[model samples]
Target: MADLESGEGKTPVIDIPEAVGVFDTFEDLQQAFYDLRMIGIHHSDISLLANEKVLKEKLGKAYWRASDLEDDPRAPRAHFVSEEATGELEGAIAGGFFFVGSYIAMAAMLTPASTLAASIAAIAIGGSPSAVIGILLARRVGKHHKDYYTNQIEHGGILLWVRLRDKEREEMAVKIMEGHSGRDVHVHSWSK
Candidate 1:
């Protein structure tokens, strides 16, 4: 509970509901959130930071405003540029999860049902067996490929700093980093 009463010789007292202590300051909190994002934990930190009601109230305005600007076609292209930067950040993180999780599942055959699903989708859509097989095989191969890519990014994929038009472009950058650059994906904004 928050300290409700305290003075000279008296101790603080509280009858309020308990509080969850996380970060003690907004700067520290944002730094932690950014650190997680930088390290491929994309979707993990926002809620934890948002739990700080005061900090959220302050930064939430900026976050929401930025998002709103992204939605406005007539807004300055710089706003959209910021969106791309944000997307690159997200892609780096989520790409890590996607590549790792999908690979693990495929490698373990955790969902032979996915093969069945692919077959059904292929059949219903009149896709060739080769196409379905390729899709499944890609899933299997993509796991190891992505794990390597994520490791590279974690180590020092610095070019991911280049701005792209959208999230897909950022994802493509991950592919490029692994295949061609011999480095981790890097997408640091100028602000970084």
Candidate 2:
């Protein structure tokens, strides 16, 4: 299938580096996953999907996985990814907006405090169960934000991308991707 897809309008591209530079290491990536309660996705499906060989041979692996609920070891549709095609997963997590934590926040709410003193007590002892409750309440306001944004990004149907700050470098990368497989690689930027 042609990677360069278009219908009524042009699709926007996103840069990877600018998206992930907020983090310096994989540990930071792990924290984001933990905060979002998304570590499990990474540990299970995402990890298996990221194998390098798997990515190249079965670029649509995850899409296929979503088509069926049951596993069939011998199924012909199985995406047999190899070991060498691993993408820099750390990059994807860093560049992509992690949203599960935000989802949790939106779904949960706080009960009003019966008295100001209890609320004050909760604030004074941060990390106390009461304080934890307060944090959860705060999260209720911001929780839906992350999940919403992440969904939009993923809805773009792009798993990995590169962000080039320099125009020349950006063109070079696009040219390279075009040369490689005519895969219709795209360049992304914050400016939109």
Q: Which candidate is the best by TM-score?
A: 2
lDDT, residue 100, model 2: 36
lDDT tens digits, residue span 119-149, model 2: 4543444234433454455454344433433
Question: CA lDDT of each candidate?
Answer: 0.34, 0.31
* lDDT agreement of model 1 with the native: 0.34
Off by over 4 Å in 1: 1-52, 55-81, 109-192
Q: What does candidate 1's lDDT look like per residue over 1-192, in tens digits?
A: 223222223333223211111222323333433443463533311232111233245334332232222112122211111223444554555455555555554544544556766655544443344345545555555454435334323422211222333455455434543444222234422111
lDDT of 2: 0.31
Can you tell me which runs of candidate 2 are displaced by over 4 Å? 1-130, 138-142, 158-168, 171-184, 187-192
In candidate 2, position 144 carries an lDDT of 40
TM-score, structure 1 vs. true: 0.18
Best by lDDT: 1
